[model samples]
Target: MIENNNLVERQYEAKNNDLAEEQHEIKKNNFVVDTEERENAIEPILGSELEGLDPSNYPLITPSIELTIKNRFSSWKIAKYYLKEYGRQKGFATKRYRVEFHRNRTVKKRTLTCEKAGKYKPNKTKPIGQQRNKGSKRTDCKCHVNLSSSEHTHYVHITFIYPEHNHTINADNKRFTTAFKHFDKSIMAEIEHAVVYGYCDIHMIRNLLQLKFSDQLFLMQDLSNAIQKIKCDKKVNRSDASHLLKFLLNQQKKEPTIFVQPLINVDSNRLCSIFWMTANQILLWSHYFDVVLHDNISRTNKYNFPLSLFILVDSEGKSRLGAQAFLNNETQESYKWVLQQTLDATSSEPNVFITDMDPAMNAACKNIYENTYYLYCIWHLLQNLPKRLKSKLALIEKYPNTYEYLHNTLYPTQQSWACVFVNRIFTVGMQSTQCIESINALIYKEVSSSLSMINVVEAIDSRMQKEALKCKFYNMEI
Candidate 1:
């Protein structure tokens, strides 16, 4: 199949090459006819016919230089611009045919051809031998200008020009050509601002543009392309981890009350972890700093860095974000660094802490809050119990004290897992990480692995603002 496809492509290219050669022949003939007409028009007037006529009564016949050797420009760019304007005035269109660049990427030569300088080849998607319903604009016209420059010279010179065309030129028809259509930068800026701020109605924008540029041409595709370019330009070019740090820094600038700290690896100089808390988040922590529940969510961004969220329960029994962090790895040291940040932010350790079964996080919690109560999430413990006991049934039967051994193994941490022991603490009826897990679900809806780090930050901020508004509307006690 590949070989057959290659053969078909080669055949198509060969046919196009043949058509180009035939068009060149036609252009050569037209040039010859044009030259002869100019020669005949400028034929020397007979000396006898001019003998009796008064020279003042006849108009002076100077040479025509509009599209000839007399038309010279200071640079190739100026020459191209002149040709474009000339075409617009004469009701025609021009396009770039080819260009050559110097070793340093400077323009060495350029050619501008008529827009209809190529023959149309039917697309292969149509069935073979199908008749066309309409005609194509391509007429193989060979009108063009050649521009070249040399290293020794600073000016661009016109090397050749063929100003004759086989088709008629109409200035009114210029508006219909793609080459003459363009959107103003101011108009595009307005469209981008509107779309970015959530006013994205393409049809309405098109109508406005048409009304504004009544004398010029406007196409729907051009407007669409402009909007798409605006979107593409907003995408971050740096690594997500790097951009994440920059975004936090900027946010700190905008809101001086916000706190942002990043840990960098000394060897690789890459971001190891970052912790940030907004002004509102800090206020929330100040009000409800008694119980802290933190857990890591993975795959929330393209880099797969775990998003660590510290959640606090309000008086209304609602989960609120105290702060957030992104970690490079799940290590004891990383967790300790984050916990220390949270400690500094709140100015004191929580009376009660709850987390999942991760040993690193558990160890970090115990070391940081040595005097505070540290409890394991009951939901996580229940989910892992069946897996741990499914294979231990035979051992329990073989040795009756196998159950006693398991009990002894788990006895030391009974306070962390047993509900009866945890009921003594003032937890607002909360004993698990279910609240944080539910908050994770809401985060997933606002952010995803495909989003850029900057966009991810913006989405998270927007979600928080909405939640805050909802709380205010219902008069929920914070």
Candidate 2:
């Protein structure tokens, strides 16, 4: 009973794991209907082509297999023709049998009886009177008599029948496709524009925009046909056809890793993800992400920073993904939409956030999540410091003792060796955003830049998904 209970618990756990939520910071993530969902939603596919022979109208025919063969031909060669009993294979070595012959001629029937191979004593050294060797031997007619090869043809017969009436129900693609295809045409057109602009190009864009079924993701075969139709495109070569469709995809990207900068505030600024991404995790992060969407986004979200990004790790630890943002210098564009999308793509709680000591981002964090901690990257701070002090960094580097004194021994201390860089030379706290620029360059490695707006989104979406799967498994949902 305990064993059974454990098995049931394990099964339940597996079921729950399979139900992993599709909580998207929209990763632009999509959903796929499961079997149970489809079945419960009113349509179940039961294929019955021949009328009147449907399973509901007619009893389901189940074929039976029998392994017992009696009074049969003795020719071992013909034994192969009589029947077969299948028991399983490999581990079980199981074999199953099917009846192969039915002869009309009268045949002898026999029973199998066992005979003892060894003798046994009744008592100590002597056999009991009259019961000397009881059950030692028994007579049975179970026998095999080989027929001459010449008579073989006269004794053996075999029959074969058409396999009929085996069936199972599956999801009805036809019905589902019909419903899917008939979705709002306007949405379809938009998706096509997005999908095509993502996967293909602008030339075919106009024509695809006019398509009625633009809102639906076509069946695999139908999608193939649609691409084939593009053979006539004058501006797009057959080779480049795939590129036209690969809108959001960076052709060169192995994958991408996105850097993040969560909102931080005195109330909530430590931004859980940032503080969690400690200095020890440098190896955990490297170059594996990208940047796209050529638009000037303004840094405006009160609770989140512009291009608040995340990271992904593939099954093979060797390959990583990094994400970066597009900026026309300091002003970020469409920030609210971007932040929302990033949130959809990443976890509500983030893992790492590498950003400048920007107050706007700090305020955003305090607004969205009131309990997270944000760690300022030491690297980003180094880069930003040069803007404040002219020759202070040079002096700090020249006066190594002062630099060490200020940065290491006396951070907040006004008088220290590192004072040239920290206190004497520049202004800004100990926390930094040093590697933020380098990290951004690394992420761009995988994000598509040459592609159109639509294609870039698609590629980013695809890459992000593969990466996000890894994150989900690791519980790095943010």
Q: Candidate 2 lDDT (Cα, whole model)?
A: 0.33
Worst 10-residue lDDT window, candidate 2? 85-94
Residues 382-403 of candidate 1 have per-residue lDDT tens digits of 7766655655656666455556
Query: Per-residue alpha-carbon lDDT of model 2 for 1-478, expressed as tens digits?
Result: 9999999999999877666543442232322234234433543212222123422222211233333222223332233322221111000111122222325533222121111112343364555554545452212212222212122232222222222212221223222222223323344445454444554433234345547434234433333223333432323332332332242233213223322233323684342222112111222343221211111222222222223334433334333333334322232322333344344444343433333445455455445434434444445446645543348766666676556644763354222123343343322232343323343454354333432322223333444443444455445323
Off by over 4 Å in 2: 1-308, 312-347, 392-451, 462-478
Over 4 Å off, model 1: 1-236, 391-409, 476-478
The TM-scores of all predictions, comma-separated, are: 0.51, 0.26
Candidate 1: what lDDT?
A: 0.73
All models: lDDT? 0.73, 0.33
How does candidate 1 fare on TM-score? 0.51
